[model samples]
Target: MTHYDGWFMLAAILAAFAANEVWRVVGVALSARLHEDSAVFSWVKMVATALVAGLVAKLVLNPTGGLALAPLWLRLGSVAFGVAAYALGRRSLALGVAAAAATLMVGTAVIAPGAPP
Candidate 1:
């Protein structure tokens, strides 16, 4: 509504964009010299993998919203099915996730017939 407010909002947006873009530019510059076999890259990969595993554990053990609707047994069983599918399907991450999601959906539908999706 005010003239200065519009300019302030524009400046804030530009600052946020610059803050994010700087990291991306830095990452690109750093990545050019880093080989996949380098120790630094290996460490980064390990850290990233650990973070993903932690996130998955958190989501499975303590889900919220729609996921929390299902019983704990269903959640753990779905994870078991996913891991088994992943191992049986040539270790394909996509197949494992899809199997887990499908298991969860079917289990929820069967276990809670009137539950909201």
Candidate 2:
């Protein structure tokens, strides 16, 4: 791509990100009056959590691009072990990431030594 094209692309990306943040900022501004324990807020939180969980599940079960080369069982097992570790460690993000990486490494070694490109 030309220099001008790259600049245009960068500007477009920045504009998209800024547009997305506007809604987030609006939400934060309105949050003061919104009851934290209200049904609507609770439902929204649940939906958000569910969406994240679904995305994680999809990534583990059917990873895209480079990850698709790995064995399916290895991915699923890694996620399971990671969830277990996270629960045992009281939902610590660092421990969860480390556990997931460790699990993925070990699982791949044991299950898919010759996984393809």
lDDT of every predicted structure (CA atoms)? 0.94, 0.85
Model 1, 8-101: lDDT tens digits are 9999999999999999999999989999999999999999999998998898899998888888899899999999999999999999999999
In angstroms, the error of model 2 at 64 is 2.0
C-alpha lDDT of residue 88 in model 1: 100
Backbone clashes for every candidate come to 0, 0
Output the number of the TM-score-best candidate: 1
Enumerate residue pairs that collide in model 1: none
Best by lDDT: 1
TM-score of each prediction: 0.86, 0.72
Q: For candidate 1, which ten residues in a row score worst on lDDT? A: 108-117
Clash pairs, candidate 2, are none
Instruction: For candidate 1, report its TM-score.
Output: 0.86
After superposition, candidate 2 runs with Cα above 4 Å error: 1-18, 109-117
Model 1 CA deviation exceeding 4 Å by range = 1-7
Whole-model lDDT, candidate 1?
Answer: 0.94
